[model samples]
Target: MTVLEADRLSADSNRRRDPISSRGAARADTVLAVEGLTVGTGRADLVIDVSLDVRAGETLCLVGESGCGKSLTCLAAMGLTSEPLIRKSGRISFLGQDLSLLRENQLAEIRGRDMAMIFQDATAALNPVRRVGMQIAEVLVVHRGLTWSQAMKQAVELLASVGIPDPAGRANAYPHQLSGGMNQRVMIAMALACRPKLLIADEATTALDVTTQVQILKLMKELQAETGAAMIFVTHDLGVVAEIADRVAVMYSGRVVETATVDDLFERPLHPYTRGLMACRLHATTTSHGRIAAIEGTVPSPSKRPEGCSFRPRCPYASDECMALPALRPIAGIYGADQHRAACHFAEDFARAGS
Candidate 1:
């Protein structure tokens, strides 16, 4: 059965060689749309003016260092934010349902069934006392209306599909008894149990080793291909972006500074922050510099953002125009450029000078 699924995914890949958005500028089907999302405590806005669309069967990677509000954005989309930190103003629409208006009970019904989140730390995500398989089966039982025995059978299959050696035996094991990789795989199995329409992986691979990260990422891609679910992958790794993203959003100080197709981003990044991020990559430094480049300074606290560009303090290309926030608008043309947008006053000037 797994082999058949693999065959189907291969055929699917052959039919659509690029990410869904690569075939066109406008996404005909949007699974999740976030508009002007702002979240904050009464003191200050932590996530401001954020917007993005996740088309069906696409992977959008949110790349930024910690504290850029990527994870918060995900939580907001899920309507999971707790006290004090309230959603200031925004709209989170998933599969035609306005999530912002949903009550906790409604959101609870939506979560795991329609949208699922894979947290960064799988250990904490999984129940400590419950058998991993039982935990996974619970989702199936609740959302898919399956009996315990039936759900258990499916859970074992899920574990096996995720590469567990002895799916049945592993299924009986507690999360603490498994390796970090195993635990992570279990979290993924739980998230995929319902075959959700939208999957949000928040730094899901951050805790894994290099080999495990690669394996987990490959597994996710295959699972996504099979499920055809829209995904929002949050991470600080550009390498992960290069490997899995169809579209990339570079966030800084709680806002997306740039957005572009994965190919365009790697070929020519428009935002200074994006460029700085790429330069920080080890692969980009084959033999040029003795040291890998580093983006100077740190992501500022939400309350401490500068008057203009939040990244202006660390950006090398800053000018006086950067003293004012630049709206995230589409980068003006050279054809096929309507989809690429950057929130930098000097985006055009920099693009032209670099060209």
Candidate 2:
């Protein structure tokens, strides 16, 4: 099926599956809740007030151009932020446990076991000298506490599950021996080794060729369905977003500018930044001589961001009111399983006109 068709179907199916329990009072299935998350260096805040929710069995796509803080938000959520970049202010709860309250060792114990991440560059992320199977088995050994022998056997099986051929033979090979796609599959196997409740894929398919990218995406969806793990898929490609995301959160200049169900965001993008991104997609209708649309200025540097809306300088719709930062608020007259929110002063007006 086409990506758009797949996206629509995925959105419809997701909408049908309520995040709330049968009692219908609360988000009982929420696997990750990140609120007011701000990550920064001593110099300046790089990620500002990002909030996101991913429910069990749902995929929330975080999309934006590079340097928009998509990866930083995920890193902070995973309690994996390193020196110089700390979680400035935020509450990150995974499966009802506040991450900030946990000790480093405690958080480490929970990371590979309960939550895992598939980073963008598998080659860089994987240990170059280690055998692929041993690397995959390491997660099982560390988190599941399986014997080395048992983990190796499961690692081979995991490789097979992710569509790697000659799983047993490949298991003994170093990362350099395999193709980029194979390395990625190995990464997926490792990430899913413990059947984590939340899987964060940061630009996971960004480096693969189109065919390989499609295969990786398909494998991830099938495995996620089988394991029933919530996923936070980060990418700059909206086409990928349509294919995999049930919900999408658009980030611009270190903040979440807009968020909605995949279908709603595509049908009626509220924020100027969101609309610009959609317009940048190369449609079949574009002729040979047609120029591709693009959002004109670069994302502002964190320390040099304009006083008000970080996006206002590049936003075509920006007005004098945009001098003040707009809060990410729900749009009125648009009701659904998920509230549509936009950090734009004219978001309500745009919604009204769209309706």
Candidate 3:
């Protein structure tokens, strides 16, 4: 079967399963399913042909470098892409409903009610002039048709739920009055206010200190468990994915290079890009240099994307076959045996050769 056909079958099978259980043993359904999503800007496709799914209560992470198009994918999903800037193609289904060709009115109706996104930079995302609580209440007022007073009350509760102390008083304070961590909590609170079926956190903890990052991630997980909201976490941090993700989709250039469970990715990464990311992340046990290590070269610009595997330019294992675009193919051995796939011609040989 073709890639698109295979993805459709996977979605169909998962839809029939309803793995996430509810009260009294009822089942909560799959929350989001995206297939063949291509997002671009200015006639140049930045990210191409991405496919993945998240059942309610599951976390699927998109991990890669800055230019790998993680943030653009989230933006496209919610219809937040600026006009004439982001052009998107392909199927984006939420609750088995397609969101790809939705009009503004339709998208607005679902943006906060069924889906919400936590932006990358928390401080900048929250309005400086408005009180944080008021901003959270806006979604309730706009979508749920709640009175301002009622929404504000629930907004304070939401803030408190995200571990914001003295939420009632803090709610009235402007964004600038809060610290970085607190602002991030407010963003989370706003995103979770409606108990959205799917939450997209685009590098939500990037700006915070390590301790605060941990706290925020823990809070997010707790919220997800409580509400059973599926999450699409976009980040460059493999360390963060190790802590939170059930499955990971590694992107390079505009496409997914590798996808596997968190353990599978760390232990037996199949794609060259995945392997490079792992190698770059490994710290030296016996080192002569104390400097932080990094992957060499840069991700090519979207306009200048290579013909073959996007990672071929940077891949240490590149060969003549790397000149041809490699489709995502199933690997012979892995944890998610049927699910394990790598877009490389030499994945098996690379594994045997211990790359």
Candidate 4:
């Protein structure tokens, strides 16, 4: 089925049925909710007051530049952030429990069992020396306490489930022996071993070619439907967001500058950063410029973030009032209520002018 058709089916099913988490079996209406999350070194905050929610079986895409804290936010959610160097504050709720309060051992038990992550560059994420099957089996052995043979069998099944050919043979191959796409399929298999309720895919397709990216995305959507796992997908590609996301959160420098449904975000972007990102798309325009249109200027470094809107320096609409940081405000435009939000001093005016 087409992506839109699949999305419609998923949405309809979500409304009619209540799916429970496979791990804790809590009343799984909300899978993950990150509220007022702050991540930084003890010296200063790198990511501030970022809040987002992923409903059971929904896909919330976090789209931004490389250093916009997209990966950092997800890392914190998974409790994967390196301690001492990285200090995380705020709530990361998974299946209604605050992960920030959990001990490291407890969090590890909950992570793959209740939540999983598909890291970027599957090659780097996988172990070079270990057989792929052994690596995938590790999750099952650790989380499900399966015997070595049983876990290996399950690992092969997981590989096949993600569309890898000859799972039995592939499982025995090392990471270096597999193609980029095949390795990614292995990563997905490993992540799904414990049937986690939440999947944080941090650029899961970044290292693959176009065809492989599509295949991996399709596989992920199928898995999400089969398992009813909520996904928080982090990526720089708007095209991927257009294909996979139910809602879009646009981040800049460390904060979420805008959050809206994918349709609303593209139809009527409320934030300047969102607009700039949308403008960079080459999918819609018949451009012969031989270059992908890019958002001008790099995202400001965390240590040197501007006082005003983080996007103000790159934004064309900056004004004198923009010297101060703009709070995320609700303004009347397109998406109603919680669907539309933007951090800008003259968001309403920008909307009016654009309209």
Q: lDDT (CA) for every model shown?
A: 0.85, 0.88, 0.80, 0.83
Error at 322, model 2, angstroms = 0.4
Cα deviation in Å at residue 69, candidate 4?
0.4
Q: How close is candidate 3 to the true structure, as a TM-score?
A: 0.89
Task: Give one digit per residue, the lDDT tens place, for model 1 in 51-126.
Answer: 9888778888999989999999999988889889999898888887788777888888889988999999999888
Error of 3 at 114 (Å): 0.9
CA shift of 324, model 1, Å: 0.9
lDDT string for model 3 (1-355, tens) is: 1332343333332222222232122234667766788877676898798877777877889999998988887887777778665656777778877776678899889988889999878889998889999999999999889999999999999988888889999999999999999999999999988889999999999999887887788788778877878899998987788767777899988788887766667778888788888777645454637665566799998898887887888888888988999988677744345556779998877656653
Best by TM-score: 2
Per-candidate TM vs. native?
0.92, 0.95, 0.89, 0.90
Q: For each predicted model, how many residue pairs clash, with residues at least 3 apart or on different chains?
A: 0, 0, 1, 0
Candidate 4: where is the Cα deviation over 4 Å? 1-28, 288-292, 353-355
| Predicted candidate 4 versus true structure: per-residue lDDT over 1-355, tens digit per residue | 2453355555444332222122223444778888888999877677888988888778989999898999999998898889654646678788899887889999989988889999998988899999999999999999889999999999999999999989999999999999989999999999999888899999999888887887788789888988988899999988888778888899999999988777778888888788888878765337647777667899988888888777888888888898998887666764364567788877787677767
Error of 2 at 4 (Å): 6.2
Error of 1 at 302 (Å): 0.9
Please identify model 2 stretches exceeding 4 Å from their true place. 1-26, 286-289
